[model samples]
Target chain A: MLLGKVKGKIISTRKHEKLVGYKLLIVEPYYGHKKDTFIAADKLGAGIGELVLVARDYAVKSGLDKDAPIDALVVGIVDREPEKK
Target chain B: MLLGKVKGKIISTRKHEKLVGYKLLIVEPYYGHKKDTFIAADKLGAGIGELVLVARDYAVKSGLDKDAPIDALVVGIVDREPEKK
Candidate 1:
């Protein structure tokens, strides 16, 4: 899992039916120099600017009854912020 | 998902009970300068030196009855090798 900051929410009008109730959050990695961001399914009610833990791939389908196309997921909200280098 | 080459198998004598019956394989990324390797749970009977797709995080626990401590999983074995750069 990687540490990330939720940047924003995604609104998709057309998506898989199994993804209907899943919240999509845009995340930026906290420790990397890479500036690109990715979207993650959020079930813990994470908010923008909050530090969260993101998991990737089919692990994204864990805890769901049906399979979805999600490649990333917001697994947890960090209880404390880490010091930056 | 990341493409990886299965380097070897891991033998864990003591692990989580939910992890029993899962095949553990060490993986090396296919397209990176990083030489470090990580272990992934494999269910599709992949073999050493085979190219496979790896999923990370809780997505690793997808399709399992109980949640395991695995952070990675081999979801597929590549049928063809990509052209080398």
Candidate 2:
């Protein structure tokens, strides 16, 4: 898992049928220097600027239709920042 | 999902009880320059030096015990490299 801040919402009118009701959030990882960002499926109602735990991979597809093409998922909102080196 | 090269194996005799029998492999991402590496749970029987698709987050927990603490998983062995810019 990685720590990321939700930067914005993605409005997709046309997406996989299984992904119809899920909210897609653009997240920027806290640990990487690259400007690359990815969209994560959110079920926890996380908002922009909220820090969240993003589960990547098949884990993102958990609890949803098995055919969903989701690649990242917001599992939780961090209540506190973890101590870092 | 991200593409990674399996570099080594992780032998963990003591782990979450739900993770006792899983194989863990060290993986390096193909698109990053950082020397950082991570362990991924493998169910596809990927071998060292092979390229594999890593699913991150809750997606990694698919098909396993729901309580397993796995964060990365090997979902597929790469049959072809994706075209890069």
Fnat per candidate, as a fraction, reads 0.08, 0.14
- State the local distance difference test value for candidate 2: 0.68
* TM-score for candidate 1: 0.53
lDDT of 1 at B27: 90
Assess each prediction's global lDDT (C-alpha) against the native: 0.69, 0.68
Clashing pairs in 1: A58-B59, A59-B58, A59-B59, A59-B60, A60-B59
Model 1, residue A80: distance off in Å is 38
Q: lDDT tens string, model 1, A1-85?
A: 8898886665544333445687766577788633335557778999988999987764556745577545677888999999995
- For model 2, the TM-score of its B chain against the native B chain is 0.85
Error of 2 at A61 (Å): 2.8
State residue B3's C-alpha deviation in candidate 1, in Å. 0.6
Candidate 2 lDDT by residue in tens digits, A16-47: 78888889999987545337678888777888
Q: Mind giving the per-residue lDDT tens digits that candidate 2 earns over B1-85? A: 8898887664533233455576766677877643435567787899988989987765655646564546787888999777767
Tens-digit lDDT track of model 1 for B1-85: 4557898998999888888999999898765434657888878788899877665664554534466787777655666654432
Top model number, lDDT: 1
